[model samples]
Target: MGRHREYDVDKVLDATLCVFWRKGYEGTSYADLTEAAGVERPALYSAFGNKEALFRRVLDRYQERFMNHIPEALGMPTAREAARHILFSSVELNTRSPEQAGCLGINGSVAGSDESEPVRQALIDFRAAGETQLRERFVRAKAEGDLPPHANPEALAAFLMAVMHGMAVQAKAGFSREMLEAVAEQALSAVPGGGAAPA
Candidate 1:
């Protein structure tokens, strides 16, 4: 081996993620990353290339870990369960941690300066991938009679994605978990053949 590393890369990435989650990509600074990640400037730069590269890695980590709930919901036995689970779980995920209250991807990319456009687009693409999967899942559900015959799977997918993202926005605005759950319940109840509204 050429050299031994002193830091746990996973811990560093997690810390950096918390920083980016609280402060968007454009708002984060070199000092923020170094202090949060505990890697120092030189070592941080040498290992991760630059802030942009490091953020991309952070995004990957967020997707792999924090976003598992989406996939878990999508894999539910019924489409209605999928919808309800995703919406309710979104509220839990967004509000579970008080300090890191909002979504990392949304928090990072909502406002991007020109210099951070690439980071913004990357986040957009990541979000779109989840939406695409949701659409496909809904289409299959419709075909399997889980959704009403007249319901449009594409529109349903878009609607759910909108609600999900809106939960993120609401969470960032300091909405309580119960309040967000009510929103999610209303969303799921409104879905065509989605089941009875939560009581």
Candidate 2:
């Protein structure tokens, strides 16, 4: 029979996620992951395949662990409330950990060399998926009269995502929670029919 693995996979992945969140995809090397995971290079490869594969796993864990606010925001009764929850929650998350004070999805691969194009694209797709969910939610809100007839779900989703991404960058740059909350408030004020009651 095959021997059992010695290291805990969940713990390793959690440590690796911290490294990636702090250093990003291209910036993080196998050495960084190995050091963070407290494992040897060969063992990491055997368990999680190449660096890219391991980074992908870390992204999944990040979404599962940190991005739960998106779903909760979508379930809000009003579009404005949904947007409020997402923006405020994002501010809390981005600034919660000073050691890794940015979004993994954004910080992971915002910019990279040609060799890292795939990783960059992966992050892009990951973010796009979230935007799609927001857009769909806004569409439902419009149908339910929670938003104005002229409200554009696509534009709203794109705008909200842009603000969220900007806030993540700002957080990484040492912006305070109050500043990010002000930014969220400013963004919320721009939403059409944002004060409307739910239908």
Q: Number of the top candidate by TM-score? A: 2
TM-score of each: 0.93, 0.96
The alpha-carbon lDDT assigned to residue 51 of candidate 1 equals 94
Considering summed lDDT, which 10 consecutive residues are worst modelled in model 1? 190-199
Please list all clashing residue pairs in model 2, or write none if there are none.
Answer: none
Name every residue pair that clashes in candidate 1. Answer: none
lDDT of 1 by residue, 90-121 (tens): 88889988778878878898654787889989
Identify the runs in model 1 with alpha carbons over 4 angstroms from their true place: 194-199
**10 residues in a row with least lDDT, candidate 2:** 190-199
TM-score of 1: 0.93
Q: How many pairs collide in each candidate, listed in order?
A: 0, 0
Candidate 1 lDDT (Cα, whole model)? 0.86
